[model samples]
Every structure is written in C-alpha cells, then in structure tokens.
Target chain A: MNEQLSMRQIVFMYLFISLSPVLRQIPTALADESGRSGYLSPFWSVFLILPLASIIILLIKSFPSLNLYEIMVHLIGKVFAKLIITLYLVWIIVFLTAKMNIYSLTLQFTLMPKTRSDFFMQIMLILVFYALLRGSKTIFRFSEFSLGPILLLIGILFACAITRLRTDYLLPVSTINLPSTIKASTSVIAVGGNMIIALFFADKLGISLTKKQVKKFWFGAIFFIIFSFVITVFTFGITGAGLTARLPFPFYITVKSISFFNIFERFEVIVTLICILSDFITICISFIILMKLIQWLFGLEQVWFCFLPLAIIVYYFSYFLSSTQFEFNFLYRYIIVNMNLLFQYIIPFLLGLICLLKRKYIKKQY
Target chain B: MIYIFGGLLLISFIKQKDVILNKKRNLVLFLLLSVCGIALGTVHMISPYIPSIAYSLEGILRTLLVNR
Candidate 1:
C-alpha cells in the first residue's frame, strides 16, 4: 500500500489500459454495423481522433494535480460543480455496468456458454472488488508487472499476423462516400475515447510530466492508432470489407487465419486471454474511479462504503439486459455515442472554458 | 453459485476479524449489499422494470426541456 508507481510504470499503465483487450472485438463490431452503414471509411474516421487529442491536451494543460472533479469545483460554483460531478459519477457507474455486462455476456456467448450469467458477473465483480480494495497504487503496480508480458505476446501475435497479410484487401479504400467516411471517423474517436479513464488517475498520478514522458505518452497513442488502423486494414484486406464487417471477432478471425508451420493453429486463445486481461484492467480502473468519486461526492471518510453500492449496482445491472446482442447494440448505437459526446467531450470542454473565463474575471478584479 | 461464493467470501471476512474491524465492516457490508444485488438481479430477470423506469424518466426530462 505504501508503494508508489514510478513514471515509467504510470506510462505503461496508461498505454496498456488504453489499448485494452475489450477493444480487440470492438473493430469487428463497429465495422460490422458501421461498414454496412457506409461509415467505415477513413475519411470521416479522423473525426474520432479529435476528442481524444482534445482531452489529452486538456489534461496536459491542467496537469500536476486537479482531477476533472477538482478542476470543475475550482472553475464552476460549488452547486454546479456538485451537480456536474454527480452526473459524471452516475455516468461512470452506468458505463462501467454496461461494460461489465458486455464482457460477461461476450464470455458467456463465446467461451463459456454453459456458465450462468450471474456466476460470470459475480466472479468479475469479485476480481474488480479485490482490485479496488488494493487501491490505485496497487493497480498501477499490477499494470507495470503485467505490461511487459502482455506487450511481448501482442508483438509476437502482430508479427505472426503480418506474414499472412494481403495488401490487396486494402484496395478500393477511396470508394467510400464522404458522409460515410466522416461517420467512420467518429467511430474511431469513440473507440479512442476509452483513454479518458486517464483523467480518473491524473490527479493521483502526479502532474509533473517531463517532455520525455509527454513524448512517450503521445508515442503510445500514435502506436495505438496505427495498430488499430493496421488491424482494420489487414482484416479488411484478408477477409474483404463485406466479410470482415460481418465477423463478430474479425481480429480474432485474422489471427485464426494465421498458421505458422501448422503448429500454431489456435491463436484465438491468445487473443481471448489478451482481451480478458485488458477487460480486467479496465474494470479495475472503473471500480477505483467509482469508489474515489463516491467518496469525493459524499464527503465520506471511507471509500469502501461506495464499493458495496457500486458492486450491487454493477451486479444487478449486468443481468438487466436480456442478451449479449441487446447489450452490444444498446451500447454501440445509443449509450457510447451519447455518453462519449456529453461526458467525455462536452463536459470537459465546458469545464475548461469555465476555468479560462474564471481566470480572466479574477485577473480583471485584481 | 453466487451465494456460495458470497458465503465463502463472508467466511473469509469472519476469519480475518483480527486484521482490522474497519476492513471487516466493509467486507460484511459488501457481502450484504451483494445479497440485495442478487435479489435485484432475480427481479430484473423476471421483468424489464428498471430500464422502463429509466426510459420514462428520460422521456419526461426530454419532453419538458426540449423535443427529443
């Protein structure tokens, strides 16, 4: 508990947690739905990149201390601050519940169909509960510990997949219409919006990011963008856009298509493990944020009080959606799009503007 | 199955009483809350009640503020 994460560990945590396993199936899901909608083209996909850049820039400017909540309080009045913070906390809880449901449902459908949904959720909740109990420093340490092996595995998988790549699949990329292309960019942005969790840890993470650290973080973000783009391109190229858009786990299918000496036949398991690990990390981060936000909002001396309520909320809500398809469709079509804009983009931008205005007013008074 | 795990976790809490009362209290509370959660989960399984409530509230708010 006394251990603090070094800057390297913090950077690694951010990188690994941002490009999480939950994202592996995301491209497939998005491409499947959005591609048909003619929104998978690169032209519009770039819009998706802006909000992440905007959020990161906002964090970098406000850095060293002051989380989104603390910053809101400083910029806005206490009443508005409390109101906004409460809404954000509810959003986080709902978002986390949705994610938990998705992951659990995905696992139930694909890997362990026989397992009861409640059982899967309970196990996940226990893991998240344990992770949250250990606190953020421990979570960061775990990230540091797991980052190396995970990266190495991912590297190997990527290397293997590259050998089987077909460049021809990437052809006719320019054929996508302008409107469709633009919408695809928003999908990419929505995917990248996962990085906003960085804000939850930004305050405790210590703000003094050196030029090197900033460069490294940006490098990681660039790496993630390129990685995603490559995976999409390759999957599309190999499977064809139409087929790629239809596969639920297209990247996994891409991995499945790879055979090195026919010995490495089942690489989908590796993808599954990676996805589960990433999901675990994300859920842990979400749980920690929930606990911290609750404590902050309620002015509670103990953070643990928030955990029970959170666990209960997550547990029950996980079962609320009748099926995996419902969870996936609801999340992608409605929840993520709206939540990403409102909470991730609009709220933060508004708060940052309010801070700027407040500063100017104070300066004028002086 | 959830109840069994919950029971075991509860037992672990009982065994760890010497660690810290504060920690024990939290474990007990979490276990109790999870019990309530299981009940809620069962209720949800039976009815699409919660989302309907959320939707209605959202609809009302949207209607009062602006056209949805």
Candidate 2:
C-alpha cells in the first residue's frame, strides 16, 4: 500500500539484511576446499574489497526516484525488462532458499539433531513469513529493534575471541599474488552482492541519503569484512590452514574453541543465534523484493497473497536438498558458481548498461 | 510445529469467511502462488538427493550464460 519507507528504517533494514551472519561462516569454511584454485589465502580481505568497491559505485550512480526495478524497466523495453526481472527473481529465490537450507541444516547438525529438517525449516519460514506479512515497514522496525542486541552479541564474541587472535596470521598478507587476489575478490562480490538490494529500497525509503548515512553503510560493511577477516585469519593461524580448511563453518569451529579460564566454553550457541537472525533478515529482504516484483509485473493489488506460496516453496526446497556434505559441495562449486554469476552479476550489469544507453538515445530524440 | 502454526494461522483467517471471500480472486491467486513456492522449495530440497536435477539446471544455466 505504502511505497516509501522511513530514513531511519532504511538504515536498520540495510544493516540487518546486509550482515547475513549465517552464510558468512560458509565462505571461509567452504572456500579452500571448493576450488579456491583461482582464489588467494587470507581470503576474507579480497572478499571485503570487492563489496566495498561495488557499494561505492552504486552510491555514486544514484537515481532520482526509480528503484533498481523501475530503472531497469525504463532503460530497457518491456520485453527485456520482463526477461531481466524473471532471471533476477529466480536468482533471489535460489539464493534465499540456499540460505534457509543452510540455516536449517546447521541447526540440525549442531543444536537439535533429533529434530527433522522439515520442522526447523517450517518454523523459520513462519517467522520470516510473519515478518514478510507485516510489510517492509514492520520488517525494518524489527531490524531497528533487533540491531543493537545483534551488534552487541557480535561485539562480545569478537572481544572474547581477540585474546586468542594471533597477529602473525595477518603478516605476509600482501604476499598473495595479484591474479589470485583478483580472482578471490569474486567471493567478496558474491557475498557483498546482496548490497544490490539497496536499489530496491532507495525509492521506497525516499532516501536522499546523507553523506553521513552512506559513509555509515560503508563503514559498517568494512567493519564486518574486517571482523570476518580477523576471525578467519586467526582461526586459520591458530588451527593451521590445513585443519581449518577441512571444517565447514570455520567460524563456528572457532567460536567453539573459545574458552575463558575454564569459566566459559561452548560459545557456539550465541554464534548460531547471530547467524540465524542475520540470515532471517536476509531472507526477509529477498521475500520483499519477490513480492514487489510480482505486484509490479502483474499489476496486482494485495501483496500478502503472494507470501504463502513462496513460503511453501522455500520450505519444501530446504527439506529435499543434500543429505550429505558432498552434495552440498557440488551444489556450491558447480551449480551456484554459474547460476549466481549469470543472474546476480552479468545480466544485471548488462541490463543496467542497455537501459542507460536507451535513455541517452531517447533524450537525444527529445 | 510449522504445520501447526501455519495451519492455525490459516484457520483463524478461514473463520472470518467475509474476509476470505471478499478477496476471493486474490486468495485463489495466492493459493496458486503458494503451490509454485512449494514446488520451488521441493525442487531445492530434492536437488541434492537427485543429483541429476542439480546437474541439469546448472547445465542449462551454464549454456545460457555461455551462449549469450
């Protein structure tokens, strides 16, 4: 009903959705083994840089009132617009579903082995659905309310883990070759690619984002990247890269390793909660976009009608995926690499360029 | 647990017959979308179990991107 979101809410939504605690652990855990052939070591740094660059570019190319969707439609004709959007929607759904599956799988593996995957997934879907049903404003409100606690939890984990951090892990960081480093930057792009969601919200939030807010978003993103970098560096440093590379969810493994004079142990629970909440926010943002795309494309009135089917599809997908770790690896390495690069990066970039050229041509005629 | 919760949510709405029928067309449309959502979810979950499905989709996508 309402097209615009508040400035403060936009900030909250961006922070909440961007952090994506759950999948954060996966890159480090999965990177080394999943053909990091082209990627560099101390992988986090390269990952951080790519997103930093992407966000900077996006901010500079600010559009007046159009979100990414409208801009794409305006730039391209209706047919191309539909094609691009359909491709984007599929990617968004797959990405969201993979995340949900990962969250459900992690919970099963770590916290509640006795529970069925279907059970955990359904609960997650309900929570996300509730958030989705409330619409973007409520979702942003939830983010605003939850942001502090989530940040605090992350802060505590970082603080407690610091004493265990070895600075030597960062040393010789510059040694990674340029080609490999550039290749590794793709991982960062993949992770940080979520920032593209900003285009969706820009118009809705009516964000004439101050230099300060833009700076804040980048600052937060950089901080997350650095935090993840430090955690991964020390984790590999302490555990040895060989051992660290073998374990999935290396961050969780690192959290599990934390101890305070025998007074504190098994801090993984806190870490898991952080991961779940972050992923939930990510899924919520994806769902919002999906709903909006459906409404805009079909000229539909009510958005809530769109939620149930989407939720059901996500739920079933989460349950039926990878019974073993090998399948998971295959999906990531072969399946996601191609699918994500095409839909997330190439098509959008091409569409954006075509739209820009078309606008220029139309203007000249006028 | 999810079924319980989702079912309850659905039931609460169903009880308000006027609300459900008032937007009957939208409700039908939503239900159809729900089926698609369920299919997508099912495909994702089963993709792992049936390696061929993953391979086929990936293969199709790869070809599309490459050809383009």
Candidate 3:
C-alpha cells in the first residue's frame, strides 16, 4: 500500500470529501436564500473562494515541508500555533460529530427509517475504524479512485434530468435579486472553503513541489466551482427553487425525476447510495484530520491510543449535537458554516498575510 | 452497549500496550478520554430525550436576535 499522499491525491481527497456537503447542503441553502436565482450564488462565491484558494496555494508552495501546524509555528511562533491548533481540535471534534449526525440522519430519512440512528452510527464507526487501521494513504487513494465514478454518475443524472428542465424555474432573474444571490453564496463559500483541508496534509506532499502539482491544485479549485455551479443549476432547473427550498434533499429529489429510457426509473436509489458513499468518505477523512490535529496539539508519538475513545465520544456526541433534521439545519447554517468560514478562510488568510511579511525570511530559511 | 464500548476500549489499550507503557502520558490521556466517552454514553442511555446543545442555542439565538 502506498504510504505518502501526493498533491494530486490530496486535491482529489478534498474534492471527494466536499461532495457530500455539495450534494446535501448547498442546493437547499441556495434555494432558501435566493429562490429562482439561487443557482447564481455559486458564481458569486468565486470572489471569496478564489482568493482563499490562492492563499492556500501560496502557503503550500512557501512551506513545502511543513503541515499547517508546523507552518503556524514558523509563521506565528510555537505558543500561538499550539493555541490555534487547540481551537482547531475543538472545532474538528464538533465538525466530525456533525458529519456523523448528518450521515446517520440521511440514512434514516432515506434508506432505513425504521432503524435507529445509533445503529447506523455504530456501523459507521466500525467502517471508519477499519479504514483508519489500513492507514491514511488508503483513504486518500479510495477518494482518488471513487471521485471519477461519482462524478460520472452525477453527470449521467444531469443528462437525464436535462429533458426535465423548466427554464422558467431558473430564469427571469431581475437585477434586484443580485444582492440576495450574493448573500446566498455564503453557503457555497462555506462548503468551498473546505479546500483548505489540503493544508492539513501538506507535510505529506514532500519537500519540493513541481509545477504539475500546483496546476493540479488550480484544477481542483476550478473543478470544485464548476461542480457546485452545475449541481445547483441542475437542482434548481429540474426541481424548481420553490420545491428545492422546501425539501431537505433537493438534489436527491431532483434525481428522482430522472428516467433513463424508461428502464431505470428508480435512479433515486443511486442518489442514496452516492450520498452514503460520499458521507462515508467524508467521515473517514474528517476522523483522520481530527486525529492529526490531536497528534499535533498533544505531541503524541502514536495517535492510536486515543482513537477508540475519540470514536466512542463522536458516536454519542453525534446524537448530542443534533437529533433531528431541523436542529441539524440550525446548527449547520448558524454555527458550522460561520465556524468553517473562520477556521478555513479567516485563519488561513491571516497565515497568508504573515507569510507575505516574512517572505524573504522564509526563503532564506529553506 | 456500554459493554461493547468497554470491550473495544480494552482491546485498543491492549493493542497499544507497549507504546502506552513507554509513553505514560498517552496512557493517562487515553484513560481520561475513554472515561469521558463512557460518562457521556451513560448519561445518554439514561435520558435520550434531552434537547441537544443546538436546541438550546437555537432557542437563545432566536429569542435574542431574531425575536428582537
């Protein structure tokens, strides 16, 4: 098995992990905020996400050998770095629990409504344990391989739904709604900012990066924007903004309208499977990142000791965080998105500013 | 359910015994976190109907900000 993750692999991982949220959260959020013009929000998000992506690329290029933690230590001193990482540890724990809760809730609402959520969470914990035991490289590789087919399935669904598109549902955008579209882009920015996850694994990208690796990072960022835009457009175009806003899983419901030659009418099953797969990968990667944060914060030589305990805590806390879909939405929109913006963009922007100030010093060191 | 968690914790500790033995801090931290997990689980088992922190926060935020 491969041990180290390449920049390409990391990019694929970010793309893969963000798929779950892009599918589940962004469409509904956009629809809720901007109605028919919600599809345009993804484009407005580029104004924020593009700069943030550039900052990430700069940070990784400047400090090729260090992860986010070590980069923080170098840029802002050890004490502050540890303090920030400690805060990260807290945020990730909550984030991981939220991911778990959402995954379970998704399953409950879609697949097995009769089964208790704790059962789903328990099974998910076992799968995550097995994946982590195989090592982080396996998780990255799984994402690398899975992303292609997942995108292909989405593409196929979009093609099928093309016939169902109602232009009236998507058009008639007035200049008056432009402000609401910009406001709704917060949902897009919240999910897109997850690209910063690349930094957490930067140390694994090795010492020197080639131009090809940098190009891959840009490809990943652009691909993410296109993916979000296309998904939102399809959801709104087929399902309509009014229904999209009302439904919890707009994309899932949108997929139900797909009929491939009248033989495959139940394509919504594929949507559920895709969601389950996306959520699984997301939870595993988030768990790995959580462990990495703990390792960095506590200076642990082996993270396995705390692994089981942390999983147990996550399993229970998933229930504690949000028991129902309503609570989950409130937590996600009010708490998690804002928190993601802070940690993923604001803090990284701060680091980029520090890197700019110490450019010559950083260059001299390496 | 608690028994399952206990067994898993025991197995994890046994699997990492050598490393935890050498690094006493890891052992302490492991036990501390495990105890916390078990405590949370017991509380949850006792009353699963408890409104989550999100619920409270939503109520507070809605009243404080939205209601105003």
Give the alpha carbon lDDT tens digit for every residue of A118-147 in model 2: 777778777886776677777777888998
lDDT of 2: 0.60
Candidate 1 residues A1-366, lDDT tens each? 224345466556656665543245545554655553332443344454444555565554554555666666666767787888788787877777766766776676457879866677777878887887777787778888887887787677667667666666554446444455555555555555665665655665554656776666566556556656655666665566677666556667677777667677787777666777767787887787777776566554565544554576677765553345544554554566677667876776676566556665644533
Give the least accurate 10-residue stretch of model 3 chain A, judged by summed lDDT: A1-10
Interface RMSD of 2: 4.6
Off by over 4 Å in 3: none
As for candidate 3, its clashing pairs are: none
What TM-score does candidate 1 reach? 0.80
Top lDDT: which candidate number? 3
Per-chain TM-score, chain A, candidate 3: 0.98
CAPRI grade, predicted model 1: incorrect
lDDT minimum window of 10 residues, candidate 1 chain B? B48-57
Residue A20 of model 2, lDDT score: 47
For candidate 2, the TM-score is 0.78
After the best TM-score superposition of candidate 2, give how far the Cα of residue A88 lies from its true spot, in angstroms.
1.4
